[model samples]
Target: MAVADTRHDDTVTCMAARLLRDAPEEFALLGTSMGGYVALEVIRQAPRRVRALALVSTSARADTPEQVASRDRQSRLVEAGEFDSLVDAAFRGLVAEQHEKDLALLDIWRAMARTVGAAGFLGQQRAVVGRADARELLSTITCPTVVIHGADDRLIPIEMGAECAAAIPGAEYVVIEDAGHFLFREQPKATASAVADFLGRVDTSH
Candidate 1:
């Protein structure tokens, strides 16, 4: 359950993948959002090491032109010392319509953004912007995999998660209803159950 630092490098997701070079000989990998992008790169770099994988709230395709432009604008805003404002704007897009007024959630999210700071966010933005299309690599994934997405996700569409499952042989796909980009936060029990069930099956199979 070790977390990889995806913010240290600003150039590519490969840098983040390298952080796992000294990880256990074989381990299960789980990632959300940009973390999922890094997880895919890890699979690409060392498929044999991952016994199982869970990709949550992420896309296999690279960023669209519009998405790239949006991220660029965000980076510019951060550079101009408008990080707080940028976080505020992004908060709306990170959750479902129902959570727009979730003040507690907003506070927690804001705190996380502040902890990451402007530089880290900029680095993450650049790495995401430069990430490769992972669709081609999906077919090559022989390890057990699970793709979990939120039914009400506003960030990465649920279709993308379905696409990942469809492409990866024997992959399990679970969509948590009423959940959004932050599905784990929105429906922690459901999210945890799905992941635990998938991993339990993987463990039993192994």
Candidate 2:
């Protein structure tokens, strides 16, 4: 199983298709945040290639105006060479209240942001802001789907995950309390355990 990471929708979709064409029988998708969005798009484009899906801290709607504006501001800040502060501001809502003071996780997130840089951030923001509503696409998804969200996620509200699960027949939803948007980083043990359990069920059922 390979993990395909790309910020742009077209690139992600194309890569997913290529992967599916090259090795149709061996891949289970697990994506977080924007990657989750890409994963959903892949499922839409090539449902037969996917065995199971794990959607974490993601939404089915395009970015709100406020979010777009915030992204614009972050882009400007990044262009102005205030990358550290921009990363810190961007990741503020990702970590839980308790882990807000955890410098280690903050540093890791900051490093990730800096590594992506301004151009990548702007491009990703544009992709997110211009994305189509995935609610309709959810109903067409027939694979064993697991939707994971943080109870304290400020980015995409937990209700969105609930709604996604409700819309998709037999989709499982899990909310990790005290976790934020960055559930994998903030609560890795619990997140991994939940994902493992979901995968186990998927394997048994299939």
Candidate 3:
């Protein structure tokens, strides 16, 4: 439940270091979206310390050139005080088209952006842009693992989740139907059920 500040750390490696400094010797890790990239770095840095890992709506690959360019553009916009527009743009991509009509959900995301503030968002964008390709580390993961993707996820495709599960030795995979990038928010029951089932099989007795 410890939430380390990732705003200042501009790379997954640095974020991983900060995580290890505060985390217990052994702990289960759960991450979604950008957090997923950070979680994979943690496993790479301290494989023996993680009891299990759960990745939701994320990918193990580095961003495509177009993606990086878009992120850079967004970063500039945020730095110039277009924070509200950045959040709005992100929200449009983070959910299924239908969820765009969900005013409550839209408001919640907007509030999150405001809470983090412009500086924090820019830092996060830098970290996200600087993240490395973690696909090679998947085969080295010995702990139990779970991968959850939304069937209608617009940000990261469902194929990315499948490939992540396939790379891991014995990773469990789940697809939340009718959900998008924010599957946990869009489909809580299914997301919680998948997490519960994964936890049931994890041995954190040590």
Number of the top-ranking candidate, with lDDT as the measure: 3
lDDT by candidate, in order shown = 0.88, 0.77, 0.89
Please give, for residues 66-180, the per-residue lDDT of candidate 1 as tens digits: 9999988889989999999989988887888898899987898899898888989988888999999999999999999999999999899999999999999999999999889
* Cα-based TM-score, every candidate: 0.96, 0.88, 0.96
Give candidate 2 regions above 4 Å deviation.
7-26, 204-206
Clashing pairs in 3: none
Clash counts for the predictions, in order: 0, 0, 0
Q: What range of 10 consecutive residues in model 2 has the weakest lDDT sum?
A: 5-14
Across 54-164, the per-residue lDDT of candidate 2 in tens digits comes to 888888776778988987787778789887777787677787767788898988897888777667776776666666678888888888889999999887888888888
Give candidate 3's TM-score: 0.96
lDDT of 3: 0.89
lDDT of 3 by residue, 71-127 (tens): 889888887889898798789888877898888888988887888788887777788
Which pairs clash (backbone N, Cα, C closer than 3 Å) in model 1?
none
Candidate 1 Cα outliers beyond 4 Å, as residue runs: 204-206
Q: Ten-residue segment with the worst summed lDDT in candidate 3? A: 3-12
Q: Is candidate 1 or candidate 3 better by lDDT?
A: 3
CA RMSD (A), model 1:
1.5
